[model samples]
Target: MAKRRALISVSDKTGIVDFARELAGLGVEIISTGGTASLLEREGIPVIGISDVTGFPEILDGRVKTLHPAVHSGLLAIRDNEEHRRTMEELGLGYIDFVIVNLYPFQQTIAKPDVGYEEAVENIDIGGPTMLRSAAKNHAFVTVVVDAADYAGVLQEIKEGGDTTLETRKRLAAKVFRHTAAYDALIGDYLSQQAGEQLPERFTVTYEKIQDLRYGENPHQRAAFYRKPLAGKGDLTTAEQLHGKELSYNNINDANAALAIVKEFDEPAVVAVKHMNPCGVGIGTTVAEAYRKAYESDPTSIFGGIVAANRTVDAETAGMLSELFLEIVLAPDFTPEALGILTRKKNIRLLKLGDWSRAAERKPEWLVTSVAGGMLVQESDVLSVEASELKVVTDRQPTEEELKQLLFGWKVVKHVKSNAIVLAKDNMTIGVGAGQMNRVGAARIAVEQAGDKARGAVLASDAFFPMGDTVELAAKAGITAIIQPGGSIRDEESIAAANANGIAMVFTGVRHFKH
Candidate 1:
């Protein structure tokens, strides 16, 4: 019988030597290339150089080595066909029983700090993916292994039956296709970004598994966490857990909501969120003061909520936070005393996000939502309007303090669900109404929540008011000033209502509609 031949080439050499040595002990001829061949030879395993079988030296810096027909025909030829046997004999070709390969580290290379375009392009593997696909296409005749994790099973099967079963070959072949497709997708995504194509015809994304969760939002649903390959700095995926139990699906969602709200503030801010909505938001000179204001904003709802602070958590803030029954606490940094205090809570999850500057430096990203049969992709909502950009539409202009409070309310209301209304005063949210069906109902809800506190506070609406009823409700609630996107057909009605009530109103023109 002719000797069984196996080709081994890999960038990740984990368990390669042991696998190769075992194959050699099983009387399988080993064929290798470049560094793999050198390592195999050094480990005392006999190897047939790829160039030796191709009958040509590796040219073009080793890129042209495995493209020759000699290597491919060996893997592609049928073992049982008489015509294939004749062709193989005539061409002096032999059957390659195994093709083991792993592609170059293009992902890793591009992840470097200052990876040049030439360096990134050089790392893209041509010969490896080609060989993997060829072997996989003829998987019925040839065995292919792209992952080192499969080495043990293949070697065991070979030791038992002298060859891998068809079933195993087919499974490994499917894995090969998935691996190569993902690799190609990564390359295409990188090149597309380099070309500055924002919305390409084909949108492809890749994510690496972080963990298999115990369950999804519900206990019955299975779920897992995946991180983007090139996630921006200060992203939640880059957060380090300092203390507490593993994060749950709900915990992550609420924490992300809190983080987004806190990012809207450059000052020391604290946001307490429940069920993906900010129950309370506060900005102050110090984080501790912010925490106090946030807690006072909605003390009942802030219980067992996710708390995120834009500034470092000092001992003073930690002391106050420890008094509450919160789920998670996230911040850019935490003092040693603060960590010690917060770590005392056994079930509370603490996440530390380093390098807060990256949040400001990050470019806009795509926000994708999965629908029944398709996905909705759009640019993220990064539009922000300054106080100076607002145009007073009412007869009364907002005072300096009212303008500051109105801007603060606008930032918080933008993150709230529409139809949304936020009542804020002194840089703190006193009431919030979100996800209502009508703008008037939302305003009423906020007014009801604020009660006496709504008097003299500024109101922010997520979108335009279709009618004057919303303005009338705000006026009745004693809301002194209001800010909203003014594009409704009945804009004059709302303006007249605001003027009649002596309430200051401003039009930002840019609507923030978050659903």
Candidate 2:
């Protein structure tokens, strides 16, 4: 039998020297490219360069080296077919038994803040992907590896036997295609941004799996957490888990919701979320007071919920947080005393994140939703109404105190599911009704939850009131003012209802339907 041959070319040189040395010791002839060959020879491993194997010098600034038929036919030819073997013999091509290749760091290069188009374009790998595809196409006879993490396993498999199993080869081939697809997607996304195409003709994104969760929303379902490849510096997805058991799928979802709401406030703020809806939110002079007010908002509903705070958690706040049966607590930082207090809860997950300002500034380019057979894509809803942007449409104007509460309620309602109603007072959420079937039902739920606290509070709706009933209900609950998008045809009726009930109303002209 002819001696086995393996081709290795990679931009990431991790584990390459050791892998090449092991392959050489196993009697597999190593074929490599410029940097890879140099690194192997430096480590005392014999390597045949691409120029030596193909009998051609690398031209076009090293781009034309691996495009030769001698290299490709070795990777692509069928080993089991007599005609293919005869053609390889006629062409003086040797069989490639294994391929280890990784593409250029296009994603890493483009992620730099100062990268330009020319620099990014030059980093795109052409010959690397072509060789990977060719080798993967003949996985029946060739073992292809892309990830450095798999190097040890491939070496062990080769040492255990003369070749890798067909199952392992197929798995590695699949990984190669996935890796290449992600690489191309990053390039496409970067070029689209450069062209100022906010919505491209074809939308593509790539994510790396963070972990496989214990279960999904339900115990019977399976789930894994994945993060976008280009996610910015500080966000919930980038948060570091500091203590406790692994986060479940539901914990991450609820924690993300809480974090999003907490980021809306510039002051010390706390938000508690359950079932992907805000159950409590508060802003105060101090984080400890904020936690107290947020906890008092709806203490029953916040049980076992995720809590996110915009400020560093202190010992006082941690003591309060530990008293509850919370699932997770997230903050920008935690004092030593706070960490000591919270770590007593063995099952509660704690995450330390970056600055809230950075998290709030990030605006995703697209919002993607998957349905049964297809996906729905749209631009992300990133608009927020400033105080100056609010139009007072009622005879009575909101007081300065009412306006602050109205803005707070507006921010909270945007994160709630559709048919959402939030009643807030003194920058604290008194009541929130989320995911109701009707606007009036949601208003009623919030009013009932608030009880006497609903009196003198302000109401914010996610969308325009389709009817005047929600307005009338809020008025009866002692809601002093209302903020809504105000686009419904029955806007006049709602305005009339607010006027007759002596309630002030403002039009934001922007709807935030979270669902």
Candidate 3:
């Protein structure tokens, strides 16, 4: 067999120097371009610049360096064809056996606090995707790598067998295609943001294989975790787990939702989530008390819901948690003894997250949602309208106790489906109406569930009332205060009814429609 040629280009220099040095020891000639070539050359390894081999000067502001036929033709040619070799020999093309490349850091660059639009557009790579696609298209003849983590395995296979195995080549080729696809999507998303339109068809989702799960939403369905690859700089996927079982599909969903809900509470808080909705939420003087109140909100729902704590979980609270059944618990820190008790249930997913003490300090711009063949994107509901901002159309202003319960109900209702209603007293939810056909129906169900407890309690509605019917119903159920997003055309009528009935009402000026 003749000596194989490997081309390596990467923006992330992590382990590239060492990987290139080891490839040199394997008698493989290294070809790279631009910064990669310059860096490899600095390490005393003889490297061939892509421009030198292409016989074309790097043009178009360095975008045309590796897009020439010399690079792609060498990568895509069928190695087993006699005519292919004959033509390659005439053109003086290299038999590029391996291509190691990762694309530009467009995600990281755009996430910077001061990144300009032109700067983001410039970070987009043209030649990198060309090389990657060409290499993947000819996976039968070459090996391709898109991840630095695969470097050791690739080197081990090459050293032990003098070539990457056929299976490794196929897998690496798959990674190359996924990499290019995700790259294109990132660019599309960026372009759409500049256009000020939420376009789902503009971007496509492609993910590399992270790990296969034991099962999917159910025990029978197949599942795997294909990370967004690039989410927030230090988002949930970047979370470090000090102790826990491998996260299941439901665990990850519930945990993420639980954290999002608990992050809303500015004070020390704990929330219990089930099926991506908060079954219980509580804010208290201590994390243990918060957890207790949240748990007592509905012990039945808390049985297997994901528990999220904004503060640390200590041994005392950890011991308390051990007494119940829970699918997962996410907190900032856990004392050594707390972890010891928590780990007794091997299947319980335990996670330690960042202290959300700074959650009140940050404000994000947009929230993204995906649909089948469509997407809906909007500004985040981080807007909290102060009481002073509330227009007091009602004759009665809510007392402090009623205000607390109203806000509590408001939080729980936001997580419920549209046309949703929740009734609450104290720190616990007394009743919940979810996925109802109409807002009035949702309200009735909630009041009915609370029964005698409905009197003097507060109610929350996810959307505006079209008329005074909902307020009339809440008055019939003896609700002392009501909270809903006020945007209806009949907002005056509802306000008049609330005032006439002496019901305390507050407008959030923000709607939480969870359809």
In order of appearance, the predictions have TM-scores of 0.93, 0.97, 0.83
Residue 11, candidate 3: C-alpha displacement in angstroms: 3.3
lDDT per residue (tens digit) for residues 1-515 in model 3: 66788899898889999999999999999999889999999999889888778888888788778887888888999988999989988988878988889888998898787999999999998888888889989988898888899999999998999889989989998888777888897788678879876544444554455678889999999888766645543345757777667888878878888887777776778988888867777788888988887877667778877998888898878887889888888887788888988988777777876654455425654555878997776766665655566554578889988888888777778777778898888776777777788889888878877788788889899999999999999999899898988989999999988988899898888888887
Query: How well does candidate 2 score on lDDT at residue 479?
Result: 93
lDDT of 1 by residue, 251-329 (tens): 8889989998899888899999999989999999999999999999999999999999998999999999999899999
Q: Is candidate 1 or candidate 2 better by TM-score?
A: 2
Among these predicted structures, which one has the highest lDDT? 1
The lDDT, on a scale of 0 to 1, for candidate 3 is 0.82
Off by over 4 Å in 2: 356-362
Off by over 4 Å in 1: 152-167, 358-362
CA lDDT of 129 in candidate 2? 96
TM-score of 1: 0.93
* lDDT (C-alpha) at residue 13 in model 2: 93
RMSD (Å) of each candidate, 1 decimal: 2.3, 1.4, 3.9
User: What lDDT would candidate 2 get against the real structure?
Assistant: 0.91
Cα distance off (Å), candidate 1, residue 60: 1.0
Q: How many backbone clashes does candidate 3 have?
A: 0
